[model samples]
Target chain A: MKQVWVFAEHQAGQWTSVTGELLVAARNIADQLNGELNVIVCGDQVEELAATLKQWKVDRVYLSQHPELNFYHPLVYTETIVDLVSEYGCPEMILFGATYLGRDLAPAIAARLGTGCAADCCDLKLDENGNLLQIVPGLGGTIFATIVTPFHRPQVATVKPGMLETLGSSENEDKAKALKPVEVVKVEPRFPQNTAAIQLHSVKQKPAKESGLQAAKRIVAGGAGISGPEGWSLLEELADVLGAAVGATRPAVDEGWASHDLMIGQSGKTVRPELYLGIGISGDMMHTIGIKGKGTLIAINQDPKAAIFKQVDYGIVADYRSILPVLIEEVKRREG
Target chain B: MQPLQIAICVKPVPDPKESTQLQINPTTKTLVRKGIPLVINPMDRNALEAGVKLKEANGGKVTVFSMSPPEGELTMLETLALGADEAILLSDLIFAGGDTLATARVLAAGIKAQGNWDLVICGAESFDGGTAQVGAQLAVLLGTPWITRVSHLKRVDDKHLLVTVEDEVEQRELLVQLPVVLTVESVVNQARPLSLWGIVEARNKKITVYNADTLKLDQKGIGLDGSPTQTRDLFAPDASREAEILTGDSPQQIANQLLDKIGWSRKGAAN
Candidate 1:
């Protein structure tokens, strides 16, 4: 039988939402191809996490646990997956969330396997021949390109997170009860004793208060029109009032007003929030493609003909400087 | 300590500022790059800058490598102007239209033919492709340890270096031995501007050209034939949603209307 594999990603001892999202996406492909849906979960003491995959419509869970697997080591992790593929026959397809780890690991694995990998794919489809068609925004996000590895087996793709829906808990429970018990395949991890090439000295976590842009319910984003640092502060204040996360365009990041992590665009994070407010942004498709959610998009720009206005649900053709303070006060007044 | 041998890999990408002008040719199923001038991928400048700085601080030679068409030699000259002691351009018809894996294979051959090196540096990702795959794949082919999204670096001793890498939720500090591959983030350093003197000196700098025959790469492993992935189709995204522009007498009035449309009230705030 055909096999479809999803690499379950977890961090800080919690299963990332993208892991569930991948499982949901892979399930569709598995069903269409009449294949078994499998998940590979690698970590230290992650038996509980691996077992939970059974409830999420997976046919099997391949667990590789070791002390060295706690944190993601590029070489070790790639070697582990390569060994699995070698032991078991190559699956028809392998999917990963386009997170930092996925971006780092997928290509390495593809190179080792002498195959191809599509990066930051937004959609996956099956061709007539059962090839995985990796869809991604291309030509500065003006077009969608369908990439395919026609002659190669085990077509690989790193899908963008937050762009797909996950199976809900109730749906998962019902499916688990209907399906047969999931098979658990435990594999031992082997590593060379000489890891002195790279030694982990310390890990400092980011402040927990700053939530990821992908998970934010509302996001207040800035662009080049956010002329300087003072402009970012104003946007941040509005975000604080609305309990929203702050996002930025590539230009804003280039101007050094925002960090790269908060950038929302084709090359940065893909966000699907409930509401997205873009201030001083021109709304290049390169930036707009990342806003995949069907949320109310509002743009505040001084130019009446700005392209961003065309893409947004609401546009204010006035200087953000003139409108921000008034809007901030109105929001606070209505709340108080 | 002896000076380090630093090798930097760079690519010439379409100018990102002019991205709106970029288009895909439906017939060819490829990007139309006729008029857009090519510049060094932005983050690769950080990689180049890091190499130059390392050479400036310690006594070392910085060699730049690029796999591009003949037009890329001009971009290589710019690298020479930026303080790379020498540059190598891997250009040939057989080397065109390769994916990241194929591209890495050509680069690995070029680097191997160049002899011993202590370090290899690349931009975390390219501006055009943005695959961020070459550095790690090159490391695998070269049999060296690799780190991506490196934000900081410092030499600890003759054989060890301290590297800071940006992870998903944390920054990791690692101690790595020499002869490592590193893909640096744009925040690693500010690239120095080109100088008139540097431009004049670049004319004297060496830029050696290598081809498939020169590198002795196996047939069916260097270009389009070697590429595993192919573009099957391309189409513009659906842009049918016309925005409803908010009009009002004043900013306050407009704000209230927007809030009303979005169904935002103090008592009903989803937050």
Candidate 2:
């Protein structure tokens, strides 16, 4: 039986949520193919890291250790993954997080290894012929794509976070175990010379007054209809009353009315909050990507055809301008 | 400063905003292109803008190159208007339905035909294909350094330049030298508006069109034959909505109902 492998993602001592998610996917594939599941963790604390994944039903773990890997160097990580995968022989499949580092590093490793790495896959399974069938979003999430790697060693995929739910450990208890040690080629590389047209300075963050959107209990999202920066005072009024963090669409961000961090869409933050209230925004797929997992989504847009309506569980087809003040007043009256 | 030979890859895209009747035959999902309006992919505007900015800073030429179906030349005028020094519409019988890899191969040929230049810039992703893989692939094909998700070009020195990449999970800044390819993220600076002079210049210049023979491209590599993947389908999603209008006898009641619908318990939600 072909084996399954997951590249564990983490920063510092904390493991990434995607690590848990990939384990879920690994468990599913392992159950389906009746295959052994393995994990590869690259960092200084290899033994400790391998021990952490043992409880998750991992059949074996490959720890690639180096003090140099404390921080990410593309080649340092990619080369490590490439060398490890090659040494492990061909597994039926390999999975990684479709995060920022994965986007750049995964495919490059795949290219270097002369294999296909399907990017941003939402699901993965074996086809009738036993080839890997991958599910991915196409054309900016307009639709889903089923990609297949018919001819390759270790069919590869990068899966998105929040796409799968972590299963309870009890259901998958006995199947998980850490593996014996394997050879990890450690390469000490001189950092490449930097030459880009932008400067990345350390940003001084404001002290925690309220939570950022990801951590916020309530979110007030201003849509395109909110107009310019000056018009944001209205949203500010509501956000203040409701103790909510403010968010916006790409258009709102492009208009310079809000900081780029506040924008939520396919190209922006993926937020899961207790309550998400969208004001005057059309719900396009890009915008929808940010708020799907929220507990409740309330949309206020004038256009019936606005894409935001379909995504929001509760939608009001009224002018946000006319309704907002009333809503704000009501919120304020109740707060008092 | 030496002139940077900048090449901008433009794609002729279907205008999705137009009342697009993109209902594919349910069984096959291929786009019904018999009536879709064609325009330059909107993200490509960033490439055009970057090309213009690079030319302004480094005193160089901007070449607008594209491979598309018949009548794709319409965008050449727009490209010229956007300040392309020259426009080469690689419209050949063999270049039809070229996927990203094949298009890159065709584009690589056209780029090679134009001789060496300082840089190549493309949108990190296109609205049409949305693969965002082409720029990286092109860089590999050309054997150059590839930087994806460049949001800003902050500074440029003799052999090095500084750029910021808003990579979401982590924003990074790097300084890289020339002979590198950059994929402009959509979140980057909005494309600058074209001046009237640019429009007039584009109107005045004749767009140069090339066929397969003119570019001397291998027919196999320039079209669908070279593409490793296929678009199994392109169909509008079946819109599904479970809807209810919170009805009330009065406006105040409606506000309360709306709040209730959004899960705002009157007292509990109050700050």
Candidate 3:
């Protein structure tokens, strides 16, 4: 039977949302190919994580536990996955979330396995020959390209987070409980002698600024049209009034008006907020691709012909500076 | 502490500012990159700057390497202008159409032929491919420890370095031994602007061109034949969502209409 694998990425003893997203994508591929879906969990004490996989739509879970595996060591993790594949023979495909750890691990494993790895793919589909088609944005996010590993056995891809949907937790829990328990396999992890060359001395949590773009319900974004620091501060004010997170176009970030973490586009965060207000955005596909959420999009631009107008639910043709204060006042009046 | 030896790998990518002009050859399923000018991949400048700064502080040499067609010579010269001690271009017809793995293999061969070095640096990813794989793959091929997305780096001693790596949620500080590969983030340092004297000096610097024969690379393992990934199809995405233009006699009127339409009131506030 064909075999498909998903790397279950977890941090701080909780599964990242992308792990659930990967499972959803992997489950579809497994059903289509009549393959067994397997989940791989590697960490210091991840038996509970492995057991939790029984409630997922998977056939088996492979757990590799070691003290050194607590934190992600690139070489050791890559070696563990490569050894597992070698022991069980190569599978048809493997999927990973395009997180920092996933991006680092997938490529290293692909190099060791002598296979192809498509990074930050937005979608995955099977071709007529059952080969995985890795869909990614290209040419500065102006086009979509389907990449294939025609001759490689184990197709590897790191999928972008928030691009795929997952089953609601309540619905999934009920359905999964009716299915048979997934088998768990334990593997012994081996490390290379040179692993000591890179030693992690400390890990510090990033300051919690601009942290919730992925899960935010409302977002207010700015583009080059916002012009300077004053305009950016105004944008922050509007976001604060609306209880929205601040977002920016690549140009705005390039202009040093916002941090890169607040960038929304093909190369940055993919946001699916309930409502998105874009001020002075020209709406390049690179930025629009990240905003295809089910939301009420409103754009304010001086140019009636701005590309952003065509993609929004409501567009006001005026200079954003003229419209912002009026809108902020009207919102406050309604609150009063 | 002896002076360090550093090697930096760079790529000449199509200028991202000219992205609107980039097109796909429908029949060949490839990018039609004739008119677009090439620039050193943006982040690679950070890597080059990091290397140059390290050399400037510690008194050493920094070499730059790239794998591209002959057209890439201009980009290599730009690196020399930005303070690379020397540059090497591994260009040949046989090395065309390679993916990340093949690219890393050819780079590994090129760097290996140049003898041993204390450190190798690269941009975390390229703007065009955006795969972010070659550095790690190159490190694997060279048999060295590798770190990606290094935001801060300092020389602790001749044999050790202190580096900070950033991911999505946290920053990790690592103490790494010498003879390592580092793929740096753009935030590591601002790349220095080119000076007139640097350009003049660059004109006199040596840019060695090495081909497959000089590098002694295997015929079947350095190009399209060796690359595992291939493009099956390419096309623009459908983005034809027609928006409703909100019009009114004045700004206040339009604001009120927009608010009412979206049901933004005290009772229905988003928060």
Candidate 4:
């Protein structure tokens, strides 16, 4: 039987949402291919995580416990997984969350195994021949391309968060009964003899600040129409009043007006806030694809005929510079 | 100061703004480019800028390498105008339709043919391919350490470099030695515009073209037939979100109406 594997990612013992998201995708693909779903979690002391995986639809859990893996090392992580794949006769397909670790490790592992890997894929499915079809946005999300690894064994792809919904049994079930029973297996840790070649001196950490774009319920995003760097401050003021995060289009980022982390697009982060307010931004497909919010969309642009109006729940035809201050006042007045 | 020898991999892609003109070949699964104009891929320009600045700071030679069609030589000349000392184009019909892995193989071969390479650089990802695989694959092929999305070169000496890279969550500063492959991030440095004088100087520079045979790569694993991955199909995505445009007289009224539509109450979220 074909085997489907997901490289479950975690940090400091907590599971990342992308891991659950990939589980959903792997489950569907496994069902379609009549394959067994397996998950590999490598970290220091991953017993709790392995136990949690037992409740999911996973059939096997490969846990590699080691101190060196507490934090992800590119060479160490890639070598650990690559060794497992070779020992298990190689799975039919492997999926990874398009997070930093996944992005760094997927290509290297594929290279070591002499296979092909598709990166930042949004969709996956099994073709009639049971080959994996990887769909990714190309040309900055202007067009979508369907990639297939016909000749390569164990086709690999990395999917971004919020792109796929998590799937399993109903939410009412207890943890163990949530899905199928899983067999947990422990694997010996592997390491290069001379690991000192790539020395990891220290990991300087940013303050524990979650990006507003990722955690906020509402987001006020801007684009080139904001004029220049000075415009972002105004948007920031409005976002503060609304208790929302500040997001920007690709142009705003490329122009150096906004930092890259604030960008919302195909090449940037995907967001699903309850309310997405875009001002002075044309609704380019590149930006729109990243916006998968369940709430209302309000597009404010001077061009009444702007493409953004076509995809908005509320369209304000006026200069955002004129509208922002007024909107901030109204929201503040309502708050009072 | 020891002279630095750098090899940069560049790809020529259709102007992303004119992406509306891009088409796909149903049979070959490759891009159909006939009338579309091409330019150096956006991020590759950043890599080139990094290379140029490195050479300028420390006396060295920066060579631009690309595996593309014969027309790519024009783009390489433009790169020379951007500050590369010389340019090499690996072109042949045999190299057409190669995926990232196949593309990286030819690049590794090209970089190997030129002896005494201290560093190799590439863009984090191409705007067209969006795979971001070649640099990592090339690093594996070259048997060297690699880093991607490098935002800045904090310090550089003859044998090592201290670089900062942006990750999904935070910024990480790494101390890596030379004989490394670096895929630079977009925000590393602003790519300087081509100067008129630089363009004139490029007229005297040499652009060496090499066919697949010149690299002496195993012919069986070099091109479309050898590419492990294939395209099943290419098509536009299904439109998922259809929005309704709201009409209001004043900005305040629009804000109030929007707040109501989303069911935001004074107390908290009401949805």
Index of the highest-lDDT prediction: 3
lDDT of 3 by residue, A1-336 (tens): 899999999977888888998898898999999989998899988897777776667898888999989878888898889988988778998899999899888988888888898988888889878999999887566788898989987999999887887878888878877888779889988698888888898999888765698788999999999999999998999898888999999999999999988999887888988899999899887788888667889899989888888888888899888888988888888988
**Better model by TM-score, 1 or 4?**
1
lDDT of 1 by residue, A208-323 (tens): 64447878889999999989999899999999888789999989998999987898977777887888999998877778888976777888898988888778888888888878
Supply candidate 2's per-residue lDDT for B33.
54
Question: For model 3, how does the per-residue alpha-carbon lDDT over B82-139 read when each residue is reduced to its tens digit?
Answer: 9999999999988887888899998999899888799999999998888899999898
Looking at model 2 chain A, report the run of 10 residues with the lowest lDDT sum.
Answer: A195-204
| Pairs that clash in candidate 1 | none
Candidate 3: CAPRI quality band: medium
lDDT of 4 by residue, A1-336 (tens): 789999999865677888988887797889888889999989888887787775557889988998878766676777888889988869998889888788888988888888888888888877899988898877445567788889888898899777877654455237666565578788876776434445565576666655768777888999989987677788989889878898989889888878878888787778888888898898877887788856778888888777777777777778888778877777777677
Residue B102, candidate 1: how far off, in angstroms?
A: 1.6
Instruction: Give the per-residue lDDT of model 2 (tens digit) for A1-336.
Output: 678988888854766877888887787778788887888777776566667676566777777777666545554566567667666677877788877666766666555554566777656677667677777665545566676655566776788776666766665444444333433333333333431222234322233332387667788998679886656888878788888899888779877888877877666666777778888787666666666453777787778777767766777777666676877778767656
Off by over 4 Å in 4: A167-173, A177-182, A189-195, A228-238, A317-336, B16-29, B32-37, B53-60, B154-158, B169-171, B187-197, B248-271
lDDT of each: 0.86, 0.69, 0.88, 0.82
Superposed model 1: Cα runs more than 4 Å off? A170-181, A192-194, A209-216, A229-245, A259-261, A302-305, A325-336, B248-253, B264-271
Put down candidate 1 lDDT per residue, B1-271, tens digits, no spaces.
6788999999998888787688776765766776888899999899999999988988899999999988888899999999999999999988877888899999999889898899999999998788888998898889888888899988888888899987668888999898899999988889999999999999999999999999999968668778899888887666656678888999889889888888878754652
**Candidate number with greatest TM-score:** 3
Give the Å error, residue B42, model 3.
2.0
Model 4 interface DockQ: 0.47
